[model samples]
Target: MTTQVVILAAGMGSRLGRSLPKPLTELSDGRTIMQQQFDNIHHAFGKRAKVTVVVGYKLEHIVEAFPDASFVYNEQYDQTNTSKSLLRALQASQPGGVLWMNGDVVFDPRVLDRAAEMIARDQSFVTVNTAKVSDEEVKYTTSAEGYIQKLSKTVKGGLGEAVGINYISAADKAMLVRHLQRVDAQDYFERGIELAIEQNRILVEPVDISDLYAVEVDFAEDLDRANLFV
Candidate 1:
């Protein structure tokens, strides 16, 4: 099956206090977050998955940074959330399984390598960190068999953070797109996935990535913390 990767890179980094968009934000390592993410995705999928980056804020910067990447713009980026950005990407994606990640995280590239293998076996799942988690992150709980039962920022005493990485099988694309479209502008992309699971449209297992270092860079402090990991 063809594998496609969609990157949600359209957000303005308001919390990071940078004029750069979140995807264009430079790390101490001199690589922008989008560059790091693209490298990882490339390493994992090689020529297997075609990648499409969704861009909005400072669209020209991202376009220049990744001239080769297919892009779907989210014109209402300032007014919408990740769900809307993802919806546009889904509409543009070819028929295939898709792997997606947020634009603002830095992590070990091997995580996606491992995720690629896991998704080949399971078809659908969310990459999660099973170590100690915080209330500030999107959290989830899994059944003993590793299928995610619930996911939310308020999922108290949950298993781990969602890590903003997820996969969907091509077989579920139509249903997934329907769920994404039903979500309101204020809701997260995860909300649609949750609705999918609730309605028995899909089953998203949890794949733990505790062995690898990954962090969503939401603020200056988060960037500092991620520096230590990289």
Candidate 2:
């Protein structure tokens, strides 16, 4: 199946307290966070996957790093959250499924292959990987059947941290985009996804992806923790 990648790269990374864009932040291996994600998808889907990046907070950093990829700048990035940044990419989306993810995460490159394969086989399915985190961290809640119930990253009792990667099918893109529009113009992507579940059209395909932990990079300490995963 042909696939496209949509990476939400507008994060300010208040957690990291860095002046540079979050996408420019490097992991233990010295690859920028966004570069790691972009290359991972490139490896998984090959050239068949054209990537669309939604960027802000040092757009030039990303532009200079990957000159060939499509970039959608969100001028409202500082005011809005991840949801609006995501919707901005819809204008240029191609006809294939999109591998959606946030830019502030670290994961094994193999995770992209697992996510892409799940989407191709499920037919409009949404696959979210289980996160590996400390015991006290808030987890996204889900039903016994694995459908995402609530993504209360701030609250306690989540089943897993969102891996920042999902396979959104073409058939479902419209709904996802519209749902995002209704979100507080300031809401982030996580809120948009939770709203999609409320619409009853969302399904959660959980992968046994404990080897890959997600770091939202909310705090500088989170960066150190992220290094442990990669």
| Top candidate by lDDT | 1
Q: For candidate 2, lDDT tens digit of each residue in 1-230?
A: 45777888876766678888887888888888887787788788886577888988888988889888889999988898878988888656876556778788777777776776677764443334454544544347767776667764573665666556676666667777888888898766667667777785576555556665556666778788878867
Taking all chains together, each candidate's TM-score versus the true structure is 0.95, 0.86
- Model 2 scores a TM of 0.86
Q: Residue 109 error for model 1, in Å?
A: 0.9
**lDDT for each of the candidates?**
0.85, 0.72
Candidate 1 stretches with Cα past 4 Å from truth are none
Predicted candidate 1 versus true structure: per-residue lDDT over 72-99, tens digit per residue: 9999989999999998998898777788
Task: Write down the worst ten-residue block by lDDT for model 1.
Answer: 41-50
Steric collisions counted per model:
0, 4
> What shift in Å separates residue 27 of candidate 2 from its native position after superposition?
2.7
